[model samples]
Target: MFKLIAFDLDGTLTQHRSKLDQTNRKVLEELDKKYKLLMVGAGGCERIYNQLNCFPIDIIGYYGMQESVMNNGQLKIVRSDFYTVDKQYFIDATDKIREKFGYTDYAGDNVDFHETGAVTIPLLGKSAPIEEKVAFDPDRKKRAVMYPFVKSLFDGFNVFIGGSSSFDIVKERFNKYNALTAYMKEHGINENEVMYVGDDFGCGGNDEQIKTGGLNYTLIDDYRNLGNKLAFLL
Candidate 1:
């Protein structure tokens, strides 16, 4: 029997960067009766928690680099793994890749440097028009074309086709699989007793690896419909 349920925020539980709805929130409150609820988000744990209006739950953030738990009265970051990278090196490498791949003309910044040293190469550039960001790589063909090359260049790092038009680079062994596995170990729970629910489970999608890694997963396509889809589980 499933003892724990981990949720992916966007497109599964809520709209992208949206607050939880009453319907789903009520579903969760009910599910809390039999299962330990958790969130596995691509963004930071604090950000995810805040977006949910600070609903009480454990969060796995930044793929797996961070994890926050609800303490007695406040949220506590039980884990914060930071890996550094050479900024100039990343800038130069991205520049070369852009030119070589014919993405020579971009609107905003090419590389998004994260505080934790993780990087996002938004193929459409950082400040691209919203319409263009939505249109540029819907099929993911553009990014997938260069994913292998970029992965090769950034050896030892885990790369994911994240968001609408970017690649997320994190330290190796820092993906959701690692985070969930680590969380399970820390809580003295069995991986087999947990089920992960997410929408992005396709090629290069952040959730793809975990699904492919032999984890029990429920694929969600739309957030609004998630309640009825998972109502039986509750």
Candidate 2:
């Protein structure tokens, strides 16, 4: 009964910042025959598209701030939204959190300001090694303890424990739930006809919004088991 199948990229489809393997790519090829496959991710549309090795699917990126579609065998951005952020405010606030949590010593920049007006506070610093970041909060327990406090500090932004060692902050109106709903409304598709697949649905997780928003979704705990988890869909 589903017409659309959306997905989260990083932890759901592949290892963090890794390429999509042939196994999952083949699974997607099978799914594409029966349903519209869309990529809904925390990163930008172009980044997701390339990571998938240009698998030929539409992408909703930056939690809905950007939308792109495949046209003529190439990805094209059809819609994009940007918001201005107070850089000083984010830097000061992140510093406060780092000091409180004893994460004051980091490798790179304290915060990452994206072109889309989104912000990220990398706990291990922006330039920290990938291995270190991955090990920093595998269970998200470290971020969970500080999630509430971070949210309190960034009242005007939607805060999520994103990636392995960072907090993703966006404007209040942007989130996977809102973005997916908007896509549904635009396409005249009913909510029940859509199924979202993702991994990060835990506390302060980026995909938490969609899960909590009551959407029909399949959780992927291990990317290696993605095909098995979604075998019923196939």
Candidate 3:
């Protein structure tokens, strides 16, 4: 019943920031034979394409700020949208949040501003060791506790609990729901003809909007079990 099967890259198809595995890759490959496969990601198009090891698929990135399509076996940037963010404002606001939350002694830069003008306020600082980041919010409780307050501070941006220990703030115009809706409109596909598979569909998660937005969604709890979880689809 699905015409397009969209996937969230990290923690859904593979481990966070990890390459696509052979097992899952083959599943995508097989699924591609029958359905149009797409990647809807929170990161950039190039980053998602590279992480997939150049897997042939169209990608929606930066929560829909950018898009790329596979043509002639090469990934081509078909659309790149940019938003100008007040960097100093973000830094100042982050500082305020940090102080209020007793996170004044971070390891490095507090705000990570992306090319798309999206911001990631890494609680542990950007340069902190990966081990520390993984340990800091393995269950995301610490950040989730501060989600409402932090989101309130950024009035116009959509805030989400991101990565292992950070919050992603994007323009109010974008989110996974907007991204997928745009995709469906562009492709002339109905909502019922699409399916979204993602891991982070809970509260404060990046995929939460789409999961609860009246669409057909499949939740993935573990990346390693993705193939089994979607076996019926194959």
Candidate 4:
């Protein structure tokens, strides 16, 4: 029996960049009774908390770089970590990478310099209109073509195909595996007791680490079916 149920927020719980609906909310309410509910998100804890309409649940954000819990009847960040990047190095490296990949011409900012050092080389830049970003990689064909090359280029860092238009690079020691492992260690919960649900579990995907961590995992392909898919688990 699964004692803990962790979920990926974006694609697994709701449509990408969309809000949780009443049906899923009710499903969550039902699940809450049977297992621990945790939201493991690619974005920040505060954003996740608000996006869920401030639903009551623990959150693992920024791929585990940040953690938060419902505290004082509100979401509170229990831990926060940040890494400083050599901006000059990033600027120089980003330019070179673009040139090598023939991405010299693009829109908006070339590099998304996040406070957490998880660099995003957005093909259409961070400020690109949603339509173009959506059109840029509808099938992830372009990103996949360059995935291996970019992965090798960032040899010392952990790289992943993230969002619809960018690559997420994190520190070597940080990932879903590290995040879940640390979470379990602190909570005294073993792998078998935790069931992880996510969409991005294929190779190079954000949830790959956790899916392959030898933990019980459920793959959620479409948010529309998530309620029915997880009804049995909860």
Best by TM-score: 2
The best candidate by lDDT is: 2
- TM-score quality measure for candidate 4: 0.92
List the candidate numbers ranked by lDDT, top first. 2, 3, 1, 4
Question: In candidate 4, which residue pairs clash?
Answer: none
- Tens-digit lDDT track for model 3 on 36-119? 999999999999998898899999999999999988998899998998998999999999999999988888788998988989
Over 144-184, each residue of candidate 1 has an lDDT whose tens digit, in order, gives 88888888878888888877678888888778888888788
Give the per-residue Cα lDDT of candidate 4 at 101.
77
Candidate 2 C-alpha lDDT tens digits along 1-234 = 999999999889998888999999999999999999999999999999999999999999999999999999999999989879889999999999999989999998999999999998999899999888888888888899999999999886899999888899999999999999999999989989999999998778999989999999999998999999999997
**Relative to the unseen true structure, what is the C-alpha lDDT of residue 192 in candidate 4, on a scale of 0 to 100?**
78
Candidate closer to the true structure by lDDT (higher is better), 1 or 3 = 3
* Candidate 2 ranges with C-alpha deviation above 4 Å: none
Q: How many residue pairs clash in each candidate?
A: 0, 0, 0, 0
Which of 3 and 4 is the better model by lDDT? 3
Which candidate do you rate higher for lDDT, 2 or 4?
2
Per residue, candidate 4 scores C-alpha lDDT tens digits across 61-120 of 988999999988989999888997777776777787788778877788988877777788
